[model samples]
Target: MTDFDATAYLPDDLLERIRSRAAAVDAENRFPTEDLAELTAAGYLSILVPTALGGAGLGLAEAAVLQQRLAGAAPATALAINMHLVWTGVAKVMSDRGIDDLRFVQTGAVAGEVFAFGISEAGNDLVLFGSDTQAVPAADGSYSFTGTKIFTSLGPVWTQLGLHGLDTTDPADPKMVYAFVQRTDAVETRDDWDTVGMRGTQSRTTVLNGAVAPADRVVRRVAPGPNPDPIVFGIFSVFEVLLASVYTGVARRALDLAVAAAKTRTSKKTGRPYSDDPDIRWRVAEMALAYDGLLPQVAAIAHDVDVLVDHGGQWFPRLSGLKHRAVVAAKQIVDDAMLVAGGSSYFQRNELSRLYRDVLAGMFHPSDPESAHATVAAAWLGPVGG
Candidate 1:
């Protein structure tokens, strides 16, 4: 990945266009449809798929770098694409390990099919290990999933919805079903994505009323609760790293804006530019120092994933900890950045105002602060009560 050019796919001109539309998209609270079309045309969605399959033939490390670049320009657009990349990334992870369960996802990316992540439920804290949705098995080995999924990004334009549900008909050995449901009448996307920031994502709630996945699309059926499934690993690794990349990018943008503001805004009390003031300098430096470690950490973990490093049981801890640190560091950077930018940043037109709202969404993604601490603590000091 050292030789990789992240901006090659994104390009400066393309990102400038995407960046230009971000504020309007946010103001209108609509999905970045034009941005998606432009990226789709650029083959940005297929970067992680193998080149033989008509993709850019990149790995997760390169993807992490590219996402950071894209997110810095337009966070909502990058986040909207993250859902699709998660599926393609999982496909790559499986194919890399000789598991072809999700190879179709890679090919689908090349074919311009959009994949939406639908694993999140309203109250399911067990995440990948358990499901509240019902997956009824049919005689043909297909499943009809009936449940509600919340926070489904790319709600308006996804071609496929990848989700999981529980099949409880078997009293003794029920399984968690992982499958992809095509867009159909059974899948209803509610138009309820109004938010303070990242409005362009339009991550709405989806209700599945007997949404069916054919036998071929039913990729996995694993025993629920802490099973060592490869899909689980793939999802956790790719999702956490990419999620961190977007937030880290936002932090980088905030830091840049802070530096720009400090160099221009003169302090009346000191009769000099804020950048020359010791306190402002300290705050900006603190923001930079905190932000600096995030990219390297993201790149290191993503590289380890790409290279298939053997982290063993510690993988969960490492992935969750990395995400936690990145998000917390990002929030801190944005807060300090707003202060450094002075009062002008409080206006809606200011980029910092939008970024401040967008960065808050990072705290709600999977491996949340509480869960991350619990995960790391359990790894170092055994779970409570042995």
Candidate 2:
């Protein structure tokens, strides 16, 4: 890749501190206080805030590396940071086109403002299929939002939101606007984040009653653009693939822990370490096979994106297939890790338990397994009606 000095953007020591703090934070179901601070101190939270604005100018590749490495340390912390990375990318893209609310991002970056993706709504089994939040225009040249957003990642901690909504009054309209809203202290948050997994993510419901969004605070919500250059697609592909990267890292650690457990425990009947058992070896081998298979696929997808870009053609199907493979591979890897670890994987106190939950999150993300498959099929086969 490019000779980008990522270390200059954020050092290793701080990442360790975040990791160390993450375990405890995950246990307590608390926000990763130290991790966020360390990230801010390293200017990692502002990696895409633009160099002109006194922030790191790292692009999507660097951002993917940061998330993947950090997720290896703490998946919850990494997932929380993923929201910010998304916001940063959104900001950077908007800024490049001069359609962004730089002041909001700039002010938020310095203010340590957390931006939540307020896309999920109550009663929606699927999170990405738009939202029920209504944004109505006012006579005073502003929009008033009235709705509750459910399971908002980093909900209680956010000072800003990348809110997605559509105006239903005009049902025939094909366009929906995404706006950036600044959260005021006056808004209320519910402490109902009781979940089976990713507890520390603090994903909860938020209520906005007549929350006024000013004109300047609104950034046009644009769909993620397909890469024109295959090479650039390779670089950008990292963003989607990194979810798999983080999950793979989590599964790898689970296997590591299992192997350690096997090495110490002796089989009562055999009077030997479990490591000597052929059955245990088989399980471990399976786990290793699963983990080993993921990295190269990601690398190849990245290369394909790069090639497509260099060749000057759309890499949509290639990129979609990459996403599909990444998600499927991640699920298989995590499931294999649990199988290798056995029933102990069910215990919340174990790291494997957390990894299990974090991996499940991937199945529901933007390019989820089914969605990725559909996108790839559509790209290759065209519409079925024709």
Q: Supply every candidate's count of residue pairs whose N, Cα or C atoms clash at under 3 angstroms.
A: 0, 8
Q: Compared with the true structure, what per-residue lDDT tens digits does model 2 show for residues 1-386?
A: 46756566556776677667766786788877777777777777777676777777666556655565677778887777777666666566445545445446755775677777676676653333355777776666566677888767776668787675555655555223456677775356788877656666787788877677777665443222332322123223444655555665566666677787778777789999988989889878877777677666655654443232342333545555655565566556666666656677778776777777777776665565666776667766876775
TM, every model: 0.99, 0.80
Best by lDDT: 1
Which regions of candidate 1 fall more than 4 Å away from where they truly are?
none
Cα lDDT, model 2, residue 273? 91
Candidate 2 ranges with C-alpha deviation above 4 Å: 2-12, 94-103, 123-129, 168-174, 221-242, 262-282, 296-324, 341-347
* lDDT, each prediction: 0.94, 0.64
Q: Across residues 97-123, which tens digit of lDDT does each residue of candidate 1 receive?
A: 999999889989999999999999998
Residue 197's lDDT within candidate 1 is: 86
For model 2, what is the C-alpha lDDT against the true structure?
0.64
Instruction: After the best TM-score superposition of candidate 2, give how far the Cα of residue 340 lies from its true spot, in angstroms.
Output: 3.5
